[model samples]
Target chain A: MRVLIPIDGSECSKAAVDYIKERPWNKDDSFLLVHVVEPIPVDIGIAYIPAAYTPDEGAAFTQSEALLQVVLGDLKSVLTNQIDTKVIAGPAKAEIVDLAQEWKADLIVMGSHGRKGFNRLLLGSVTEDVMKSAPCSVTIVKSAHCSKSE
Target chain B: MLLNLLSAPKTNLRSLTNMKILISLDSSSSSQRAIDFALSRPWAEDDEFLIVSVVDVDRGDMSMASAMTSPNKTFNSEAERIVSEAKELLHNYLPQHKLETRCLSGPIKQAIIECAKNWSADLILLGSQGRQGLNRLVLGSIAEEVLRDAPCSVQIVRRKFSRREDQS
Candidate 1:
């Protein structure tokens, strides 16, 4: 089984990681951790954008990369298996759903606050979009503890 | 057929509370897929399963409710049969565990959420019809609503497509 998990380093995102820790696993099953970095507006340095990279965009990419490493490190300590990690930049909902399909993930596990930007936005919940569009099963972990109810 | 641990790796056996699971059921094939998926999972020994089927009924008129009550009573009987059959099917699979079945009358999403909340369910399993794009938005979905306001976690299970369906 191939599982895809999207995280954003929020409390709920860590909770999702915790939730996965409590579940059972199989030997051949692998994990793909995805972190989507929302694109920063290019307006900050548009005059210099046409040449090299803008400062704002460069800063944003660096931040997202650091977060991905932190999350992967935390997961590596808890899990003893083959785990793959990827960091992409795009709209949170579209990127997550697209990656799950492209990777042929058997399941997509997302946390309550895993979406980028504000949790609930005008475009609809990012988690909800992934749930609706992903090519496989989707499990939304609200509370870190599976036994706990909201 | 049996491997080691898949993705969700850990098995925290310390918290030994009986897991309350609410599975939203219907007469659709997708719902059966959800049940099959749940049954195939390696649940804890103390896990308790609750199968609930909701009969969507308008609040305006209880006596003339669409699915809950009909002049010929077809919908009411079918709803009861579905839930009862599900209970029996599940019993055959996991007879040692505790199980309960209920037929609720109300809006599909509201009824399922209410049952899950009252039961203090640890998890909810729902079947997605796999409707796409405009259709989903126009008709909405019970699974969507329950996911937003559920008392606990929710899993949306989809039916596995057959080889013949894949070609199309």
Candidate 2:
């Protein structure tokens, strides 16, 4: 099985990593960890060009790499299968879905803040977007702290 | 074989030790896909499964004539059959696993959430038909609601896309 996990350095994303670690995945199963760095808005009154990587974009790329490394280290302790990481700069939802499609991921597991009411409507959820567009199964893991009970 | 755990005493003993999984089903093929996804996954030996189908009695038009004719009976039996069929399929794959089935009646999303809360399920698995655009907004999505309100983690199974489908 091919599992794709998207990380964003949030508590909810960490919970998603924890969820994956706890599962008893097959030995032959492989995993791909992805982090998408949304472009930083600039106030320049000129058309932006993709020819050169801005310093801000470079820093975001570096930060995302570090994030993936930390998650990969944690997964390495429990999983011995082939685990790979990718860092891309794009909208998180669209990038994640496209990566799943390109990689032929059998499952895409991600974290959701699980916001409710007006908050959810206001914030809009990347997890929800990915769930709608991903090419394979999608599992939304909520942080244990946020989960509601009777 | 579908076993009803409503009155089963072993639930108390096994509740804490096993992972309780609540799988919501309907008459749609998407629900069958959810069951198939569950069967293909690896589970702990003692993990218990509860298959539930909620009969939305209020859905569709309820006219006096049809109401007098006992549409509730038909809806309930259909719900029962859906759950039992799902249970039987899962039982065939995991014959030794503890499995139970129930037919619930209420608003579909609320019933599923309430059942998961009451049963203390560790996970809730269901299917999403991947309805897009205007259809999704107008019809709304039960899977989305359950995922939002569920007391446990939720996995939404989707149709497997082949390379051929992707190309087209």
Candidate 3:
């Protein structure tokens, strides 16, 4: 089976990776690791700059690159041999579905936040969207051992 | 010949017990686990099994509403296709044993609870994605809800980790 795992570099996402690492997957099965980078609002960077210290486009680009490196590095360290990884720029939910379709993935493995009540309404969950939209099956991995602090 | 062996006067068919298992599937890996769990059991030939997939009514209605507003009317076709596909997926997995399926439309938790009640299932099995924080705050956990409200027992099967360090 071909599996697509969408990661956001959050602890919850890492928990998903951890869950997969512990599972007994078939030797022939392929795993794809996908990270979607939400488009950074250019206005935010422009808004924060002072008249005397204008934010350079080069600097912003460099900063984004550095952040991506850290996230990708952490992902690489956790992934096992033979797993394919890709970093794309788009909405997390939509990109995940797009990648799944592109890969013809048989399954999508992800982690859920386990939110409730008003908190859930205030912040819509991407896992929910992916679960509803994905062409194939999905698995949500919640961290059983980790508490709110860990 | 096998039937004759089983028909020996000493054998009691009444003594043979069949286990009842319930599988909740939604085109996910956890559904696969549910299937594997059911198949792995040392079930007698007469054992009964049920496979259920809950279609969220709110989601269906919301999509339908959105489609009505769309100018092209293309969303209607898309929605129909999706439902048809879901049904096909459900049918593909059914074989042997006593298999039944439902395409319920409503809140996932509510539909599941209703089904559990109507079926009087012995065990409700699910896969957990383990979403929490903001995501959980929004999407709600069907497994968690089922665990809390189901009339019968609930079993959550998580994905097996591939790494030794990650294992618990």
Candidate 4:
């Protein structure tokens, strides 16, 4: 089976990695670990603070790339040999679905905050969007256990 | 509303040997994938499988209401049609496994959650459309809501299939 796991550098996302590690997967199964970097809102950058320290368009692009590399490095450390990693830039839910379709992954395993009521309504979960739109099977690992430590 | 029921303390695991599993059905490839995944697992011998198809009354009013309320020979005929199709599909895939089928009326997500709680299902499995972009943002996904509030563990299946690439 081909599985796609999306990580956001959150411990909840890492829980998915741990779940797979504990499972008894066949040698034939392959995994793709994906991380999506949402495009930085240009307005936020322009609106904030010191004009001297503010980066130009080219400099901002470079900074985003650097940030992506750092996040990918963290992902690489936890991912086992069984998993392959891909880092892309876009909205988390859309990019994840696109990658799943491109790879023809049989399953998508990711983490959920398990938000409820007003919080869920306001936050609008990415896990929810992925569940609605994924072309393959999806497994959502709720991070209730992670919240306890916080 | 169903969240209250789900939040109730979990039943003893030791007494759950014969638990039921509700597999939500649609014509999507992802739904079929979920069925395949469930069958692949080693479930207890006494466990039951209930395949359910919910008719979303809110989506279409007259047609759905007529199908459910008509007492004549044509009563719930559309629902029956869907139930039959689901049964055929399930039987074709799981011929040996004993299965039960039901067609209920309500919102899809709410109906599925209620059925899971009513049946005390140990797990709920669903196949997602995997719709993305602006379309998905406007219309929320059922699989996501079920995952968050389901009384039991929920599995969302997407249709992506990957083959192992040999490293050697």
Candidate 5:
């Protein structure tokens, strides 16, 4: 089986990785870790003249690559299966579902919430969107904090 | 650093035995596929399963009134049949493991979650109706709502891509 996991360097995402590490998976199953870097939105204002400032694409990719490497090392310690990593820049909701469909993933494992700052307000639009359009099975792993509260 | 972060405090070793799994099933084909997917996975020898189907008394006005009035005759038999069918399917494959069937009457989502919490299930496996477009917008998904509030990890099973492609 092919499993796709989307991470965002959040505490909940780490819980998802831990869940995958503890689960009993087949020896031949493969896992792919995908991290999507949402592009910084450009300000569109009609009244004020803004300075010419472009978002640094290079820095964003570098950070995403480092995160993936760290996650890969952690997963490798527990799993002996074929593990792969990919860093993409796009809307997380669309990229995750598209990647799962393109890769023909059997299952998608992810955290209930992502690394957005205002977590209390925007609970998890990315997860909600992925769950809506995923072409395969989806597993939503809640963090220890969330589960304990219930 | 990453390894340390990933190491959440686990109370007990999550071994492949004695896992309590709660499977929520309804009369939909999506739920039937969920059972098939559950049986396909590798489970521990001593794992226990609770196959449940909620009567959804609040869904229909007539059923709600009947549930309050007659109680026994209020779509309870349908829920019993749903759970029994799932139990029979699993029993053929896993005869040694403990299998229990239950019929619940209440709101569908709340009943499933309440049962899972009381049972202290390790995992909740259910099927998504796979609703899309305007229908999806109008009617909310129970699987998604369960995933949000479930005490344990929730797995929303779906048909394979190959099978879906063949059908389309």
Candidate 6:
């Protein structure tokens, strides 16, 4: 199966990786790990005083690339089947759905309710958006924290 | 408001020897893919399979009262056809399993959940999405809702694809 997983560097999203790795899926199944980097927030400069050095667009790209690299490193330990990584810049929900549709992925497995469950007044913002809009079947694996709290 | 076409006996004889697997079925291609995936798994001697189809009255009705009325004759026949077709399709998967079929009415998600709970299903299997063309504004996700609240674990499957489209 072609599995598409979108990660955000959150432990919850990473737990999605852990869940897939632990499952002894057939070796023929391949995975596409996609990470979307939202553009630098417009208010970053105004929201906080320049107590620390500010990052330019190049700095931000480099940072996001490094984060993807770290995620790739972690996944390397678990995924023996064919796997690929992609880092793009766009809104999380739309980009993830577009990638899955364009890729014609058969399955989308991801962590559920990672960031917004506690603070955003609603649960599963990005994951829910993808689940509702994606072109393929989706599996929302509960994060370690989300499961524990439940 | 949910309706059951088949209210299983309180004591299901098959549950003792098999895992009661509730599989939601429809005429859609995605639903076929879900059945294909489930049957591919190596089966134990007794693994119960209940194929289900839910008619979403709420989606088409303007009011809950209109939707909650008794199942119309047209719907009753349609549900019967769907149940029989699903049973026939599952017959090829494992002939020894003695598969069951059911039809549910009401909002799609809640009806499926209620059926699963009533059957004491060990697992709920369904297509990730159903009959798309009604934009997100019209309908949210049935699979996502079931995943969050079902009494048991859920598996969402689709037509298997490869990493690259050309390879498939």
Name the candidate that leads on TM-score: 5
Among these predictions, the greatest DockQ belongs to 5
Q: Model 2 TM-score?
A: 0.80
Better of 2 and 3 by lDDT: 2
Q: Supply candidate 6's per-residue lDDT for A23.
A: 54
Better of 2 and 6 by TM-score: 2
**Compared with the true structure, what per-residue lDDT tens digits does model 1 show for residues A48-95?**
332122333565555655666666677677778678887776788899
Model 5 chain B worst lDDT run, 10 consecutive residues: B159-168
In the range A1-150, model 3's lDDT, one tens digit per residue, is: 677877654544555665455444544567787666565446557444333222233443344344445434544575444577666666678899999889877678775642222243222368766766677656655443211322
Candidate 4 to native Cα RMSD, angstroms: 9.0
Q: Ten consecutive residues with minimal summed lDDT in candidate 6 chain A? A: A48-57
For every prediction, compared with the true complex, DockQ reads: 0.23, 0.22, 0.01, 0.17, 0.33, 0.10
Compare candidates 5 and 6 on DockQ and give the better one. Answer: 5
Residues B1-168, candidate 3, lDDT per residue (tens digit)? 111211223211122134344566665555455555443323445545666565543343344555556623443344344435533543454345565555555566787788777876655666553222126354337665665455544555544423331221
> Model 4: runs farther than 4 Å from truth?
A9-11, A18-27, A36-81, A87-91, A114-124, A132-135, A143-150, B1-20, B26-48, B55-100, B120-122, B129-168
Model 6 chain B: ten consecutive residues of lowest lDDT: B1-10
Alpha-carbon TM-score of each model against the true structure = 0.75, 0.80, 0.44, 0.56, 0.80, 0.63
How good is the docking of model 1, by CAPRI class?
A: acceptable
- What's the DockQ of model 4? 0.17
Cα lDDT for residue B136, model 3? 39
* Tens digit of per-residue lDDT, candidate 6, span A1-150: 678988765545655665565554556777888877665445546442232223334544456556656666666687677778877767789999999988878778887665433443243678767777778777676533444455
The Cα RMSD in angstroms, rounded to one decimal, for candidate 6 relative to the true structure is: 10.1
* Model 2 lDDT tens row, A7-78: 776555666777787776766778999888766446545454454334345656666677788788889988
Answer with 5 or 6, whichever has the higher TM-score: 5
Report, for every candidate in turn, its global Cα lDDT versus the true structure: 0.68, 0.73, 0.53, 0.60, 0.75, 0.65
